[model samples]
Every structure is written in C-alpha cells, then in structure tokens.
Target: MVQSASIQLENPQEWDLSDLYQSFDDPRLMQDLEALQQTAANFRDNYRGKVKDLSAEQVLDCLQQLEAISQQAGFLYAFPALIFAADTRNAEAKQMQDKVMEAVTGIENQLLFFDLELKSLDDQKFAELESASVLQPYQHYLYNIAKFRPYKLSEEVEQTRNQDSLTGRQAFINLRSLHLGEQEYDPVTTPDGKTCSTEAELSALLFHPDRDVRYEAYQSVRKVMQQHNSLYAYILNTVAQDHKLENQMRGYESTLQKQLLADEVSEPVFRAIMDGTKSRFDLWQRYYTLKGKALGQKIRTCDVYAPWGNDPVPPLSYQQGVDTLLAALSQFDVNYARRAEEFFLKNWVDAKVRPGKRGGAFCWYAHGKHSYLLLSYTEDYNSLFTLAHEMGHGLHFAWIGDRQSYFNSNPPMVLAEIASTFNELLLLDYLLKQAEDNPQLKQALITRQLEDQLNLLFRQSTVSRLELAIHDRVTQGSFDQSFVNEQWQSLYQDLCGEAVEVLPEHQVDWARIGHIYFKPFYCYQYTASNIVSLACYQKYREVGKDFIPGYMELLAAGGSLDQVKALRQYVDVDLENPATIAAALKYVEGLLDQLQATL
Candidate 1:
C-alpha cells in the first residue's frame, strides 16, 4: 500500500497573484480576450493568402505578433486551470477552466493554417523570410515548422484534424481525468482512533509506521480499484486506441516513436537508459532486503514503503524546511536560493491541506511569468524533501521565464525531472552532513534517501519498461488483461529478486499507476533524469563555485535546446553512456553500505 504524507496545516492560503491580472474576472482578462480575437482575425486577414508577396521582415513581424498574442492568452488561461487543479471541487473554477480550454482550442485552430500556408510557399520565398531580422528570434521555431513541410497535408485536412482533436482525442483525456483516474479508498482508523477516508488520509497510511496498518491500507485501496477495474480497463483501452489511431494518421511508426520525436530525444538514448537500469536491478533488490530486515518482515509489497523500525517522525517545521532548502541551494548557486526565497515571500506556494483540495503535488508555470506550487505540507523530513523538489521546478521556470518564447518555454519530461531530482540530492547530502554527529540519525536519513532513490530511479524504470513492453505488445495486437498483469508481475519480481515476497494484488500493480493511463512511458524519464542529475550533482560537489554559473545557465536555457545539447552544455554527461547509470547505482550502493555499517 502507498501511504500519503501527512498534511496538517490549518488556514492554508491560495496563490496571491496580482502580477498577471487583477482577478479571475478582472478587466484585463476581458481586454486580453478582445485583443486576442482582434489580433487573430487581423493575422488571418493580413497573411492568410499573401505569404508569397510579403518580404522576409514582414513575415517575421506577423509571426512575432501572433506569438505574443497567443502567449498573453496562454497566461490568462493557465492560471485558473492551475487553481482549479489545486481544488477540484471548485465548481465555478472548473466551469471557467472548461470555458478557457475551449477558447484556447478555438484560437489554436484559427492559427493552424499559418504553418501549412508558410510551408506551401516556394523555396526562394521561404528562404527570404527565414533571413528576416524580425523572424530571426523565432528561427528555431520556424525551422521546426518547416521540418514538417514534407508531412504537411492539404490545408482543409489539417484544419479538420485540428478541430476534431479537441472534441475527439483531447475530450477523451478529460473524461478519463474526471471519471477513471479518481482513486477512492476506504476509511481507516487513524492513530487517534478516528476514521477518515480522504485521498490524503489514504496516502498517509502508506507511510504508517505500523506494518499491519500499511498492509491493510494497501488492501483497502486495491479493493476499491479492483471493483472499478472494468471501468479503468475501458478508459485505458480507449485512450491507447486513440493514441494508436492518431499515430497512424500522423505517420508515426510507433507510439514510443511519437513521444521520442516530441521529446527531441533519440530511441537509442531512451533504450540505453532502460538497458542500464535493467542491468542494475540487483541494487534495488539489495536495498529492499535491507529495508525488509529493518522492518522485521519478509517484505510484502506493502512493506516496500513501510517506515524503518519505530523511529519517531523527525519534526520539520515549515520555516525550517524552507531554511534548509535555502541553505542547501546556496551551496550550488546564490541565484537559486534567492529565487526560492522569493516564492515564499510572495506567497507563490499554496502549502496547506484542506477539504476538497487536489491529491498530489505539482509546480505550475503560466507563460513563464510566475510559478505556483500546490502541496499539502506536513512537518516531517520527507516533507522538507518534497518542498525542495517542487521548489526546484519553480526556480527552473522562474530563471528562464523572461528569456524563452512560448514554444521554447517548456522542457521535456525527461529533462524536467533533472532540476527537481538535483534539489533532492542536494538536500539529502546536506542533511547527511548535518546529522554526522548523530550516527543513528545519519543512518536513518541515509536509509530514507536510498528508499526515495529506489522509488524514483530503479522502481520507476522497471515500471517504464513494463509500460513499453505492454504498448509494444498492443501494437502487435497481443496486449490483454492477463498480458499486462503478467508483465507487471515479472517486472516487480525482477526488481525485488529473492529479497522479498511479491503479494497477489501486486500482479495488477500497473492498473494503479495513473501515469500509464494519462502519460504513456513517462516514468522512464524519472530514472533517466535522476541518473543524469547524479552526474550534475557530483560536478557541483567537485567544482564548488565554478559549477554555479553552469548550473544557472542550464536552468535558464529551458527548452531552447534539446535535452542532449542542454545536458552536454550544463553537466558534460552523455545519455548514451552505460557508465552514467552505473555511476548512479554505485552511489546508491555506497549509501546502502554506509547504512549497513552504521545501523
């Protein structure tokens, strides 16, 4: 069973934002909406048919104007959607979110002709526009658009595809989010002997210090899911089928191929990371054995996350956690520290738990203007780590906010995890050093850190491999319920090895991972990014002051460069190297050795 961390803050505040607009119903939103409609109309009127007649400079100006208009509207749409996610029960916010999504989708459809029309221009005309000064800033975007020239369909067909997407493929995603993805768990008696059954409460049970409670919580959650499996199976099958159909229509060779193309990463690089992780399954098996011994159990699936011994939950105040994060970040770069401090001072974080709030944590950046974080803060060591993790994402967005265009603003998921995981590594190392005087505390911290690494790195990689296999089988018309369950069980057993006993429900574990339903093959990036970040963290430790500038530059680069180029410039780590994964595993092994010796 997966227990959630505790969330006990009362009077939790929402994001205080007067930066983008005055309020949700502020005049500025209306003004932007009017301007967007006008500009989009004007763009269609001016450039819809005269692309061959316009000079390169004129074309660039038109593109820039369109980009600016789209970006402003994006900012307006994003904030409310983020706020709604933080509290799904907000009916008004939900309605506004749906309205904004429809508006944005309509606007996007209006601009869909711009690319196909541009691509239709003759070579000489296209070349002239590419060299225009006004368009130089967006040359990369233009170049990418041009790259799709060969794949371009007729303008009418493209428009139909664009419009159909919102109501067809995209609407299915919304349906899944609203219905199938909600995990309902049965109420369990808390330590105070009161029964509660909220998502937050069920999450807390996963980390329960008592093995029996953790097992019971796991069963209760799975039972609810088991009852809903048929519904979930329907959602999964439909989404996967939608993706397969779209990929075929888009001329993509495979589902993973589409993701790789979008991520700007090579299939070889992704496969390398998977292969490297498969080679290091023993590290996870060893760690689980140690964890099982520590918990005095023959490790059931629920015991994977069970607390070690009866150690008192280390109390971490919110301010203390912030200070700890600031101090650790200061070691790498002062700018990161300052940016994090600004988030707290400005109330950019909604850090309290309340009724009807969202279940998970995320950092939301609306048009690179400001970042908002949503989390239910609990005063525990893991909470501190979580704070740092989300703040890492916030800082990354903040650093690059001013510099990147909308198209280049968001990094790929594989690279996105680097900043967050790097923060975790820095905080863990800092805490380990601070606890050096207390051997037992140091051992416990080390164990906890290793547990996290196992989850994010090894275990997530295993899950990704299973997902890839499942998708591949589906493409070959071989996937079914039994096929998915068998593959899940195989991966779990492989990772656990002989060190632990796999429970029965654990066989259908893939059904519980929300990402597979929404984000196919996204879990592998968690493993890859952590491995890449370990190398980056090692550089920061070795080079000290010299590493700060490079680190800051990497964050500032955002999605301006592809993942490989960005990492190469920032940390000099090659994704193709098997040694990168080996190095990360070696670090994990060292931590385990230290814990074993000390404990």
Candidate 2:
C-alpha cells in the first residue's frame, strides 16, 4: 500500500545546453566539425611518418595541435550526448549523436598514424626524446604511448578497426541505449491505483516503505527484461566477443589487461579488492540481517532500499536538497561550495524525473568548459545524495579544468570515483551530525551509508565477478540466456548468502546493468575507489582542517601525475597495499557496530 508519505514537488527543473551549443541547427557545430576534419588532415599530412625524426620542440608543437583538435572533437560529441541523455527518445538528438560519432571516427582515423608512429619509436630513440627538456611538459603522455607500443598494429589495420567500430562494438552499444530508451515497461500500479510508466518511475518505487510496492516494481521491470533476454544476451555476447578478439589481436594476455594498462592499476591490486570483498561477504550478510531486525521483518531483495524506523522519509524539495549539499560542502571548504554553486546558477544540471531520460546520474565534463550533470530526481533523501555524488564529479573536473590541459585532464576511473564518493561520505557525516540526538534517524542514516558501501564495494565486485565469468564463458563458447542468468544468480546469491532472498526475477537482473554492456569490467573500480575515499575521509575526520590543502591539491593534480604517486604524495594513501582495503572494511565494521547498538 502507498503510505501517507508526501513527495516534495516543485517547479519543473531542467538544464540549459546552450553553453554547449544553441541547438542542433547551430552553425558552430558543423563549422567545428569541418574545422576538426581539416585540422586532422593537415596534422596527418605534417606528422604522419615523422614522429621519430622530429626534434623535441617539433614534438611539442605536434602534441599541442593534437590536443586542440581532440578538445574540439570532444566538445562536438558532448553536445549531442548531453541532449540524448536528457531525452533519449529525441530523434534529432539521436541522429546528431550518431552523426557526430561517425565524423569523429573519421577524424580519429586521419590522426591514428601519429600515435602509431610514436608507438613505433624504438627504445633508445624514445628515451632520448624523453630526455629532452622541450618534451618534459608531455612526459606522461609520451610515456603512456610508449607503454602501448606492444599493442600497436599496422596503421592500415588500426585504421580499419577504427572505422569498423562504427558498425561493430559501438553499434551494439548504441542498440542497447536505444532499446532501453525506447522500450517501455508495463505500468506499475500503486496501491492507490496510481500507475507509473517510465523505468525511472518504476525504480523510484523500489525505495517505497511498502514491501508489496517494491516487489511489484521489481517484478514489473525484470519481467520486461526477461521477455527480451535473448536480444540482450546477443548484444552482451557480441560486444564481449569483439572485446576478446581485439584483446587477442592486440597481444594482451587477458581481457582485463587492456583496462588495467589504461587504469594504471596492477593485477595484484585488482585481485586484492575482489578477493578481499569475497572474504568479507559477512559484512554484506550482517548488514541485511541488521536491516531485517530494524525493520522488524525479514529482509528481501525488494526491500533492500526500504526506509527504516517508524517515520517515512520526509519530503525534501530539490532546492532544499541543494542547500543541504552546499552546506556540507561549505563546512568542508568555502571554495569547494562556491564552485558547486556555479553548476546550479549556470543551469548545468538536468534533475527532473522525466520519461526516456537516463536512469542513473552522471556528471559529464565538457573538457575545456564546465561540467554538466544529469539525473532523474525523485525528490527523496536518496536523490539528494545522488546530487551530491555527481556534484563531487563536477567539482573534480572543475579543479582539473582550472589546473590541467586537455592532455592531462582525464583522470583514471579509480581516481575519478574517489572525488565523488568522498563527497558522499561528507554528506553522510553532515546528516549523521544533524541526527545525533535522534537515535532512529541516526540509525536510518547509518543504514543508508552502509547500504551504499555494500553497493559500491561488494555489489560492484559481484558485478565485476559476473563480468569476468561471462567473458570467460564467451571464450569457451557462446553463452545463451540461461548461462548469463545463472552466472548473475550464482554471484549475487553468494553475496546475499541467507540474509536476503534472491527472487527468481533477480536472475535476469544482469541485463539491467548498463556498465556491463557499455564498459565491461568497469564496476570493480567503484570498490577500489571506495577504499581510497574512505581512507581520505578518515584522514579528514582525524586531522580536521589540516587535511584540506593536500586533498585540494589531489583534486587539482588531475591526470597529470601517476595516480598511485598522486595518492601517495597528496593523501598519503597507498593503493598497492592490502592494508588500505582492510582499513576500509574495518571502518565499515565500525558502522555495523553503531547500527547494532541503535537496535
């Protein structure tokens, strides 16, 4: 039954994309594309085969030109992408996104030879070039290319793969987007006979205090996935197989090596996170058991997000949410809060819950420009945290844009997640302090924090494990619907243990994970970054104001320095150590103790 909880409603909230471009018909869009194509052609004509022979000053000139071209291309793509994300059902936006992608690919094909030539540079020549003072500015960029030397193919073959991706991997990715965008599920009927239509609306119900509503919403959404399981399975198989074939051709020994190479994370560190998460599955189980005790009912998969205590979640308006978030940031640093306010003032966030908008929240960094955030806000407590999380990403990119060039602005996913998750911890701290005198509210806030950790740490690793199993299965033979379902169920069940019932519908839940299809092996980074964020947050708690300088510097460093070095230098956290992961779990255990005392 729908409880008497009143949802906070306000004026319609939307963002302005005029900063990206006036509209799809904007002449600057086409002019930029044309300019990009010509620049790439001129660049290729100048530097295609001369990378090894160029002087250090000449190499610097080439890189600067390439950086300018890359930035413009990124701007072109961001316009349509932000549009499509705002309303995936917009036909014009879809067409524009597709058109921009093809054009960008052509530009990339033209510029491919420059990188291939750099990769082809022999060790002595590469070292000699690196020693030159003129090339010092791009030392990391030069080193990055050098590491991929073994993976470089002939220019002809590389160009062919680049062009084919339009119809190959990218096509499958697009199909998934369009499928989810255009496909509507059966309406979820609330106890009051109110019917909710879009996936975002259905997802909002999963947090309802009423058990029946959550289960119905869960079943309604999964049933649709079950009906289209075959197509999803095919899409997953095709994309994974393409990844596998490409990895094999690129001389990578395993599917994950390519990502690790890009992420700068070592194999031991990856295993430490995954293995540590599995070893501590009791943390997950214990949390669910605690949840059941607090709710005074048995926990189920559908009730994972249910509110605790007697009171339903209070109605938090969008502006109220922003105020709370900014207050939290202001307590941390006025500069941080000031930067975040610009996002709201500039109309850079799309927070309305509308049909066909993407389900999850993401902050898209527009390279040289400011960041844009997108999310379907349900005007609830959880929505507030989602806002803070993405705002963390926005602030991180803002710092990067102020300090780093285009070549150095892209932080690895692991590092990128720290800034975002740290913001979440800050918000949690602020909320818990406000609820200090109210034991039930404290317990509720603590439960939310714990559950988010479980999702970020354990659940993400489970997703990672399922991804690995599926990729392995594809290598052995093509997998059908049953195989994918069983893998997800087995991994998920292991994580759940006996604490929560895994409904039959939960077996097809893998299809709902866009990351698996969009970027395989991407979920584990959440777990990895959670550890670092916790450590950073822990330091902030202990040192108070003293921790601000290094932390701010860490954010400002962006991708210019090595991530491991950056963490160690600024935050004094080491990613390679098993102790870091153990410290994070121990902190989680402390939260469990607090929750138990409240009960």
Candidate 3:
C-alpha cells in the first residue's frame, strides 16, 4: 500500500481475477489443464507427420483445433501469470505459474511438428494449400508461418530448445523478476527528513519539485543497480549467448532480423527509425537547454523528469483521473469511452501500490475477454498518463477481441504501441483544452507533452542503439559491467550532448531496463510506434470527425491484416517512406514552437 502523503486516492483499485478463475483451487482450472494437455497430445498423434498431405478441409479442421488449444492454454496461463504479476512474492501463485508454463511448453513442443512439417512442404504443395478457399480466414496466419520457413530448425531440435528454455534462457529471466521483487531498496529521505521506501513511492519522488529529493530518489535506485551490476551483466551476457547460438542453429543472419521477422518489419524501416531519431539529437539537447533556462539552472540527468515549474500538475484522485480520461475518450468516440469505462467498472485494473508488486504498468489481455491493467498509482500527473496509456492498450485489444480470433488478436510489435500512445495524446489534448485560460497549467501540460515525445522518440532510440552495441560487442568478445556501462554513457553523451550532466550512477542504468533482459529489440518499437501515432494524430487534427471511423477500423483489423497494408488501407500513412519519419519530426518541431511561444 502507498503510505506516502503523495497518495491521492482514498482507496485504490485492485483487479478481480475471478473473471478467469474463482480461486487457485477451482476444479475447472485443473480439468481444463488436463484436457488441454490431452487435446495437444491427440493433435500431435493425428497430424504430426501428415500436415503436408492434408487436404484444404483437413488443414482447416486442424487449424480450428489448434486455435481452440491455443485459446485454452492462453486462458490457463493468464490466471497464474496475472496473479504472480500482482504479487511476485505469492508462493502459490509463483508455483502455479511455473507449473502452467511447464505444461504449456510441453504442449507447444508436441505441436511443433505441425508447423515444421507445414514449413517443410514443397512450394507447389504449399501453394495448393494456400489456394484453398477454406483457409481464407487464416490466410495471414499461414503467410506469417511461411515467412519463417527459412529459419526454422528440425522438429526434434525445436522441441529440445523449447523444453530446455524452462531452465535455460527463461530461468534467468525469472530470476531477474523474482530477484527485483524480493529485494528492498534504501529509504529515500525528503527535505523534511521524511523517508519513502516502496519502489512506487520512491519513483514518485522523481517528479518532486525539489531537485535534491529527485537526485536522492534517483541515487537510491542507481545504488541498488550498481550493487547488482555483476549479476545483471551475467544474466544479460548469458541471454545474449543463448540468442547467438540459436541464431546460428536456425540460420538467422542477425539478431535484429530474427526479431523484425516476427513483426513483418524489414531492416530498412528499422534503420529509418534509428537514423532518423539520432539525426535529430539537436532537438533533444535543445529541449533540455530550454528546460534549464526555464528552471534557472543547468539540469542534471535526474532533473530530466522533474516537475517543470513551481506548480506541478495538481494531483487527482483515482475517480477524477478516470473521469477525465472518460471525458477525453468520449469526445473522440462514444464507443471508445464506453469501452474504457468497462475496465474500471469491472474491476479489471490493479492500481494499488503494494509490496511485491511489479514496478511499471502493463495491460494483459485474454482472447474473447477483456484486458487486466497493472500499475502502482500515486496520483500524480505521470500516474494519470500511465492510466490513460494502459487503458489505451485495454481498449485496443477489446476491439481486437470483438473482430478477430485468439491467434489473430495480438498485433505485431511495431504496431502494438499505437493505441496506447494515441490515448496519451488524447489525454494531453483534453488537458490542454481545459487549461487554455491558465498559463501556468498550460505550460505544465505542454511541457509534459513535449518531454514525453523526447523520451519516446529520443531516449528510446538511444536504448535501442545500446542494445545493438551490446549484441555487436557480445559477438566480438565477452564483456563485463564496465563495457555495458561505457556503452550506455557513450550513447547518452551523443544524445544529450552537453545540455545535461550525466551522473556516474546513470551509467549502470542499463541493468535496470527489464526489456533488455527479457525481450530483446523491444525498445525500438516505442520509437517506431510513437512516430506512427504522431502522424495519425496529425491527420485526425486536419480531418476532424472523419478520422474516427478509419482509426476504429485500423484497431478492428487486428492482426488479420498485414500491419503495413492495414495502415495504408485504413489511414494514408506509408511507413515505408523515410519521409514519414521526417513528417513526424516536423510535428515535434511544431510542438517545440508551441513551448517557445508559451515560455
């Protein structure tokens, strides 16, 4: 629970997992798990070696069965996974999560032959399968599987890898999570000598108006990371080595290519984001300089996230925040607002700040159902934005669930952040409109908007660059903590220039980025998605009401359509063109102009 005076909500919301399961002891949960295992076994026995020879109708039948198994397995996985996320220290939840994971992996291993056999089919046979009208509903899914034909290993080898991951690559990932959840941090003291502990409480101080409090809170985080630097370095290196060996085994040319293939994104599009953002480092440095000028002092790296002026954005209770979000969404589309409200009314969000809870917010969805949003809300401006961001994800998948099947509900990584970030933009637009008469409030809102773009566009690109460097360096030779620290410092130096002082503790920051340890190449999508959303928002501004229908259509398309084609079809955005990035940056420059005028 948030014991800090900073808490504004009298009673924060907690999610009801009963939607998935009444309790861990639910007999239905065990029955479903056993049935899922048996179904997967039957599937393997029936079709393991016959996928290539199956007729179109037979293939469609197998696909429907496969989809059912996936949906059931996903449901089972969600219950314990969400439970563990809400409370990592729950022994029963962690055990159940592990058990479910092991079962799911075994099941996946059994089904591996289906895809491997399909991939191994001769081109003529595959083409014949594709030409079947019966398979039209899964055309994109089949096509996606075909895209990885060149990289897949033999069935036996694939299953071996899958089974080994329980103790291999995945165990280290779990270690990082469990370790972070179990450890306690040093108490951060305020100017009045008040002490704050919990990660959420300490993190909230980053936005404190007092610079020393921000610095102390920042140091409190960094000191812990520094102490655990060696352990994190080992985990990172081991995961990198695992990926490297897998790439070699599977014949992937590079790590980046392996990740991009899943997103259906080409190397050129990724390079465009990397080069496009790095080229605009000047804009990043300029904003910090402007921030320093406004604050009457040169800012430190810790001050980068500090409140902009003497008057930070006023705190709102949980209800007030939700109401404001509902109003903003209602203005865009009544259906969207209604969908956003469901999460709150249904107790689908976990907003309480408690020990053993994970540090940031995330929206998790079960197919044919709703999304569960987890965040430790401290009732600050950032928490309000966090609520909006996660709600964006919730609303997005709700639309997806209504329009697509389980397998097709998850959008590609590059397109995943679109709805979430767009929600933040809507919230900002609403806040700005409401603050039109108050200059101080207007400045705070505009500054928040500008700084958000800077973080998503510039800071994320730097993180991606560091990821590339880490992988590239690992391929050359083994590295230690100093190597990773140097890579982080050098990258920030290039991005921040001399505008802000890069503190020594900041060098160990790489160890704290969960994405680097868990999901490789994930940070870049933040930059990529922000670029796409900004362009979409710009179009909305020009076309007004007409844009809502197309935007809704884009969300409803889900993963059934090729993301690139879906964007072009629903909205006129062409991500293939490098000029798209330039247009987005031009919009950022317009934001800078707004800030300058406001100042």
List, residue by residue over 18-75, the lDDT tens digit for candidate 3.
9799989999999999999999999888887778779999998988888889988888
Report lDDT (CA) for all predictions.
Answer: 0.74, 0.87, 0.87
Q: Which prediction has more favorable TM-score, 1 or 3?
A: 3
lDDT of 3: 0.87
For candidate 1, what is the TM-score?
0.91
- Model 1 off-target regions past 4 Å? 1-12, 17-31, 52-54, 120-136, 180-184, 192-196, 476-483
Please provide, for model 2 over 270-374, each residue's C-alpha lDDT reduced to its tens digit, 9 standing for 90 to 100: 999999989999999999998888778888888899988666667677877887788888889888888888787778889987888877889998888989999
**Candidate number with the higher lDDT (1 or 3):** 3
TM-score of each prediction: 0.91, 0.97, 0.97
Task: Write down the worst ten-residue block by lDDT for model 1.
Answer: 1-10
Can you write out model 1's per-residue Cα lDDT over 434-544, one digit (the tens) per residue?
887876567667778888888877788888888777667767663456667778888888888898788888776666677787678888888888888888988888887
